[model samples]
Target chain A: MKIHEYQGKQLFRAAGVAVPQGIVAKTPEEAARAFETLGGPIAVVKSQIHAGGRGKGSFKEQPDQRGVVLVRSAEEARQNADRMLGNTLVTIQTGEEGKQVNTLFVEQGLKIVRELYLGIVVDREVGGPVLIMSSEGGMEIEEVAAHSPEKILSEPFDAVAGLYPYQARKLAYALGLDATAVRSAEKFLPQICRFFVNYDCSMVEINPLIITEDGQMLALDAKVTFDDNALFRHKDVVALRDLAEEDPSEVRAADTGLSYVKLNGNIGCLVNGAGLAMSTMDLIKLHGGEPANFLDVGGGANEDQVTEAFRIILADKNVKAVLVNIFGGIMRCDIIVSALLNAYEKVGFNVPLVVRLEGTNVDKAREMLLASGRAIIAASDLTDAAQKVVKALGA
Target chain B: MSILVSKATRVITQGITGNSGLFHSQQCRAYAAECQPGVDVFVGGVTPGKGGTTVDGFPVFNSVIEARKKTGANTSMIFVPPPFCADAILEAADAGMELIVAITEGIPVMDMLRVRRGMEKSSARLIGPNCPGVITPGVAKIGIMPGYIHKPGTIGIISKSGTLTYEAAWQLGRVGLGQSTAVGIGGDPINGTSYIELLKMFQDDPGTEGILVIGEIGGSAEQAAAEYIKSHVTKPVAGFIAGQTAPPGKRMGHAGAIISGGAGTATEKMAALRAAGVVVSDSPGGMGDAMKQAMQR
Candidate 1:
């Protein structure tokens, strides 16, 4: 549910939070046109990806190019966009494999007198949304929390009553804003808090909440993450999702009603529940085997979804074996067995497959598997299933 | 005596006319009927429109107020859909139910946030919004977990995952360690109850001899529980956390199962629990043996 910086800025603009004028561009020509449209002497071309640390991130193909570049001319903006778009970006957040940047945000650069941080997060321990303000900005909040905890101040607001004016003023004063900037922050900070509550946001961080030389407060950067469950109420926000930034297998798994995360290993795991799937992976590791992926064929999955899951797992060339562990409650075990058998018949499993079925007509599933005689190994329980899968891999 | 539900506990079902509500209600009712020192757990049902009717011989009331007024039901189990679950919880709280077990999953975090705030002022204790509820084995079963897998003994259990709760209970029962009560606190970022809350209850309850916790990667609930156990809890406790191999930042099919800001990883939670003198098992397959080893000391 993490939105790109451009999308987050759009939300910030809609919420009356001041942000620099920006245009999303898909090509170098578009970047040049956006720079001209802004009438900017200085523009920042930021790569649009779901991860953070973009300003410090570097492109894999062009080592000289950064994910976020500051250009003094329109031609430099176009050049930066040309080097960034369709290239892999490796940030602290994006891991070593990195994500591809398909779009760029060409925005007007601001002359800042001071940069501060403002973030709203759902603080579970506090039992409500907490507003975090700090004098330190443009750095990872975690580092600030670890090294200089005293520099940060937090205000917890009641979800029902929401952030009060005094709370915002208190935070503004705590961050040591000047009188004029404090007056502006009094209006700006509450709007951000209100935006967080109104939009069903899990997190909203405006890093480098900048104070201009003229003493006006503006959000220089924004990163917003919405609650996935709350997306049902806001169709507009759901449309902002960039599928290209996500793993294709995970995207396909979501469409197919399965939860799948591909990893580096040999055993492919398909389990019913999230907890059990993770436990299954750990069990595989304990049996001296590594899991290639984590797949949960959620409750009430049919034959086709199971088949789709098999195809997705087999698509991974590193997977040496498949482990199917299901403890059905609402989803009957017999149905899972039928789906597995049907999938095996259609997909023609090349890897050694181990199946463990439990709960709700489990005996019927075991009998069906035995009668099929499809060379699929059946397990007595979770432990047996893990041991059998590892043994099947000849490890 | 169990921590929550026992033979004396009276239960009411919300959204009883719905498919899952009606089905699980019957299963729970049948389970209570066969349990030792048999109890009638399903006292009434609540459906907004279908009041005064009956679903499979259980009386249905229009609202929680009417249901509580008629049946004297003290506990309410909700099986409503995600959209209306927050309202259902509020209704039960307004009706003065002592314990509210929300069996519905996928409730919006905002709704839970508001509900948690409202419950802070109310008297009722909420168990879950997306959980398997609570079960006092050989006494009263109040959730969707398999009744056959549980047995009444000395071990008390609290978990965040539903099936893993069953998996642990089944494994413990296989090793002759029957449970006193097993509770699933649900896998939501903002749930009503926490491991620390239940740990205190288990510490005070005399029937419980040992405790088992089934946690996952998410939140600092386990860390908080570890801190609580260090100074407060005296019982030998064994813990197992799921998602040891799960990649960071992924949701892993549960909303509360993500690692954020380098916190709530399985390794971190396990290290915390181990440092608190709680035996922590690496694999779910070895959880029972770990618990047994802890108890032996």
Candidate 2:
């Protein structure tokens, strides 16, 4: 689950981290008032969306050097906010339709001396929470990692024991901080670790954590992703989830308790388990077809879940064909076939459906589908089923 | 001659009082009874407050300690909920259970981290907290895997992804290379065991002639295991990595399966395994044939 930048800043503030004074405004009128509350001559206006790279994409447009007179006034800010709200702003970070701007952050602009990247993530190799600090910030961290991996310092901490004092100091030293900045950075590390563990965050990143000319550290931008499974524990974080930034098919699948992720392909897949879903997609590609999505109906798939799965797969516009691969162990194939037929009758699937059902009750499942006399095609092997889907899609 | 479990291993179900726990526990008991005559594999159980009760004539104790004390059960299968899964794992570990297989998913990484920290001091080995348990075939089946697919044979299997275990086993069975033991270590970002952990076990087991390891894009667990196999293990190993269809930016299966800036990828893992002299298959269909060839070599 991804939280908006403004919400991430709010979480940082709650954790006692110092951020620029800002207020989230929905309307242009609210934007001017928020500017008034900040009492700053030069305020930074930012679009609040789930994705990053807003500045590079022109989503975040600063006032022209000619100095547009109207934007300085309250009425001008109102008109600007109104025009931008509800409109999709395309960024390199935001794929396709860009991100819809529902809210804007009016913050006090600061003079930056240096931009630094600071983040905490669950490092799989270390098997603990790792704090990533770098002198280079604002740019794609991945580029930095590839070009100069040594620029980034990863300090892992045992979550149970919390961040050690020496570890925090070590990161502060690695950041090459001055005396006061070193103390400040040291103060913030443990707090951020606490925020990470308590909030169940998969990643908490502050890009362009700027050092003001006056030598004060300020978080200019924030990106936080929470663990979706841990959402049950934190309702506040769950409430911050913006469904607009996510794929509609995936959201629908989530609603039906299915794990679905959209990809750029033509063949829609409905598999029983996560591992099988991935393998099915891989096999489809190996057989000269692209998988449209990864949809796992989970282990204990029943009639209702399978029907919902079919509905979700059919809803994808890019899906030229459908592939149902069920390596049934705990789940029965006859039940899945009946559910597929039930969903087919209700939704009236227009695309070709190629199914490869194996394991328990496979013979009965094949007989039931064949007995329906429907246009449903069945294959005995995964490769054959993938081939059929690819040929049908003209791939 | 299974790896982790056999007919002599005593089993206990942790969340045996719950709906899923009770149902699967009963299924396991029935399977054990049908597979072997007079085999008291599932001897005791633990469900916190539901102690002093019996489910299907097997004793249910309050704690793992009591279950171990009363029934002498060495192996435990967990069906606890996600939130309490870490505690259940720790309890079995603290009680000195030799093997603990956790079937619960959605466990928080923090909880698992703490549980793992505690487990570092204990002698008990952990299998999974979000996996489909382990099966030793014809001996004592400790997990939720369909007992029918497995047969006592020479192939030892270790997989990070669960469903691929079933696929590998099914394919291996087709080629007459049934498994001695199959373990699903799960694909969560933070898990108890690694591919190397299970590979070491498979390497030591004498009945296992060859190993089939199914990995996916994620952490360097597969690479580490490949290095281990290259240096130490004499037995032949066949490998297949899933996530060839995953997009460059998208996460494929597990949270750990993100290929950020091109670090851990299926192609990279495959290359590493191949360089390590492991037979790496190109497709899931080729897994059985690859294993067969590796065994012959």
Candidate 3:
């Protein structure tokens, strides 16, 4: 659900929030053309990826090359784009494996008089959305909160009302903005907060929110993420999802109505509920086995979904063992056992498999699995399943 | 002496006549009948516009208020769909139900946030907009947990998941320990009731001796619960935090089960629980054992 900086800016601009003029470029030619079209003395070519800390990120191919660079001309923009596009970017947020940059954003550079941070998140403590502002911009907010808590100012706002204009003005003044910039923030802050609520955004962050030389406030960088559960109401935002930014196994699992997160391990987990699945993974890790992926078939998954889940789990070559943990409540264990048997027949498990079934008709499920005898280990409980999976992997 | 519902608890089902609503309603009634000879704890149902009607031998009312008034139902279980489930919960709250159990899932976080605000003005305590509801072993079966696995006893359990609650409950049963009341707090970021509330209730309930809390990665719920346990709880507490192997920022199936902002990780929650003198179980399978160990100490 994370969108690139350019896409975020597009959302921002569409919402009437001030942002530097920008063009999304997919190639070096497009980036160069965008730079030329802007006719700017200074333009920024930024690699478009979901993760933050892009400015400090470096290209893997050319270690010296930054993912984001200021270019003065079309040729320089093109050269930077050439180095950035189709290259892997490693950032503090992206980890060492990095992400492939398939898109570039060319934006007109501005003379930033002052830099501030603005972030809106669903605060667990507040039980609603809260807007956090800090004068220490362009730095990690968590770090700022840790080192200098006084520098951060936060206010919880009603989701329907958005951030009040007076509150926005207060934050602007606290950020050391001039009278003119504070006036502009009354409009800018509330408008952006409206954009966030309207889009069902889980997070909207603008780091280094700049005051231009002309005293206008603009979002220098926008990092936006929408609530996945709220995507049903906003198809337009769903269309903005970039599959290139996600794991293929995860994307495939989602298409089949499964919640799958790929990890670097050998044991694959298939559980009914989120907490149980996580507990199963933790137990596997506790027993000295790494989970290859976390897959939850959900509460009421049927035979087809189970089969697809198996296909998706086995699709990962790194998966050396498979553990199926289904805590069937209203969904009876006997029915889920039949589904598991059917899925096992279709998927043809190559790795050692352990299945833990609990709840309604559990005895029936155990008998059915034992009768099927398809090279699957039936675990007695969660710990038994974890131990069996770890043992199967020889961990 | 369960914390919430018991054999004497009368229940009303909202969104009854809907597939899941009617089905679980009947199942809950059947469980109560089995637990208490010839008695149905689920008195009636509410399906708005279906008043003065009967569905599957259970009288249907137009509203929760009508059902509560007519059947003397003091608790309400909701199975309404996501969009309207929040309103259904508020309706139950408005009707002055002592306890409202919401079994519906996928209720938008926005709706839950609104529900949280609305509940602040009401006295009715709520549990699970996306949960398995409450079960007091043989006394009452209010929501969706399979009734067969639970047994009546003194260990009070609170969990953020449906099936994980079952896992812990069944594990306790296997170890010859039983639950006084096992409550699913639901696995959403904005749940109606949380660990702290249920933990305090369990701490005060005389029937409940040991406490078991099952939590996953995400939010400060576990941390807050641990802090409460440290400051106030005198009962032995056994705890388990899932998603130890979970990667940062990945939502592990549940919307709330994500490690965000480099906070709300399994390690942090585990440390908090351990520091609070809680016997934190490393394996989900060891929950009952953890409780046994905690009680022994």
Candidate 4:
């Protein structure tokens, strides 16, 4: 649900939240053209990736080149874009295996008098959305939260009413803004809160919410993510998703109606529920087997989803064994067994399989699995399933 | 002797014309007949525009007000979709229903937040928007969970996961332990009730002897419940925290099931429960045994 910075800025513009003018470009030439189009003496070429820390990030191929570069000329913009595009960017957030810079944003750099932070998130404990602001903006919020916790200030707001004008003005004043900037913030901050509510945003952070030399408030950098469950209502936000930034296997799993998260282990797990699937993986590790991935075929698994689940697991070369643990409910154990048998035939299981079936019509399911005459190892319970899968892996 | 529901509890079905709604309504009616013959626990159904019609021997009403007025139903089982699910819940609450059990999954958190605010001013108690719903073994079954596995007994259970709730029930049944009442609190960021609220009820109820809590990686509901158990709950308590293998910030199928800001991990929840003198199960496979150990202590 995380949108690119350019996409976020576009949303900001639509919401009447002031943002620095920026053009998203896919090529070095487009970046140059965008720089010229902006007609600014100083332009910032930012690598567009899902992860943060782009300003401090470095390219893997050209380590000397930064992910975010300050360009004084159009030629300098193209040079930085050429070095960044199609190159892997390593940031504090991107980990060792970094993301490729397929897109760049050429923005007009603003002369900031002061930089401050503004964040909005659904605070689970508070049971509503909360607005967070701080004096420390350009730096990582985590560092500010950890070190000088007093510097960061936040307030919980009602979901329907949103952040009150007084609350917005309070934060603006707390950031030590003068009368003009505080008045501007009273309007700007509430607009951002309204934008967050209107768009179903789970999180919206404007790091370095800059104050220009002329005393106008604007979102210098925007990071926004909408609630995935609420995506049905917002088709436009769903279209903003960059599939290239996501793991291909995960993207495929979503399309196939399976919840899959690949992990670094040997035993592949396919279970019915999210909690049970995670618990199954934990049990595998507890029994000396590392799970290759976490896959949930969901509560009502038909033949195709089960087959895709297996095929996805088997597709991983590291997976030494497969564990299928289903605690059947509305979907009977017999029906799941039928799906498993059909999926086994379609997917062609190459690894050792350990199956544990429980709940409604379980006896019939166990009998059917035994009657299948396939090389499926049956376990009596969850722990037994974990032990069998690990034993199958020879761990 | 169940906490919230018994065989005498009257029920109404919301979104009764939908696939899952009609299907589960039929199953629950059948279960009611099987457990207590000719009870007629399911009094009416609610479906807007489908009013003045009879579906499967149940009368459909347009509004919750008419349904409550006609049937005198005390409890509502909702199967409405996510978009209108909040409205359905509020309608039931506004109609003065005692209990509203929402079986609809994928309800937007904002909708639930608004529902929470509205419920604060109303008298109705809500259960789940994205949940399997509650069940009191043999007497009343009010959800999509398979009814045959549960039986009448003493272990009071509350879980965030649906199948894991069934898993614990099945495991407990295997060892000759049956549930007095098992509740699925739902796996959403904001639920109608919390573990602490339910635990307090379980402690006060005589039907529940030993308590089993099944939690996952998400908010600090489990930790809060653990603290409540240390101070208030004298009953033997056992706990299980799922998703120990899950990475931080990854949503594990469940919308609320994620570790963020270096908190709400399985390890932290387990540590909290352990420190509270509750028996925390090492693996999901061992929940039944852990509860037994707690009872013996």
- Pairs that collide in candidate 3 are none
Worst 10 residues of 3 chain A by lDDT: A380-389
Give candidate 3 misplaced runs (Cα > 4 Å): A61-64, B49-53
Candidate 4 lDDT over residue span A1-395, tens digit each:
89999999998899899999999889999999999999979999999999999888898999999888899888999988999999999999888999999999999988989999988988887888999989997987878989999999998888888778899888888889988898889889888988988898888999989999888899989999888888999998988989998888899999998999988999999999887888998899899889899898888999899988998899999988999999988899899999999999988888899999988889999999999999999999888898888888884
| Rank by lDDT (best first) | 4, 3, 1, 2
- Model 4 chain A is weakest, by summed lDDT over 10 consecutive residues, at A386-395
Evaluate model 3 with DockQ and give the value.
0.72
DockQ of 1: 0.65
Docking class of 1: medium
Per-residue lDDT value at A114 in model 4: 94
Candidate 2 fnat reads 0.62
lDDT of 1 by residue, A220-274 (tens): 8888989988888988899998888788888898889898998999999988777
Off by over 4 Å in 2: A59-83, B248-253
Using lDDT as the yardstick, the better of models 3 and 4 is 4
Q: Provide the DockQ value for model 2.
A: 0.69
**What is the Cα-based lDDT of residue B189 in candidate 4?**
92
lDDT of 2 by residue, B1-297 (tens): 667877677899999988888888887887888878787888877988889889878788999999999888998999999888888999999999999999888887777788878998898989877788888777757777777777778899888766678878888888998888899888788888888878888888888889998888877888988899999889999999988777665665466666765777889999999988999988877898999999999
How accurate locally is residue A167 in candidate 1, as Cα lDDT from 0 to 100?
A: 86
Query: Which is the winner by DockQ between candidate 1 and candidate 2?
Result: 2
- Candidate 3's residue-wise lDDT over B1-297, tens digit each? 888887669999999989999999989988898889877688889988989999998999998888988999999999998878889999999999999999988877877888888889898989987889999987888998889889999999999888888888888887888989999988888887879889889999999999999998999999999999999999999999988999988889888889877899999999999999999988888898999899889
Per-residue error at B196 for model 2, in Å?
0.8
Residue A272 displacement in candidate 3 (angstroms):
1.4
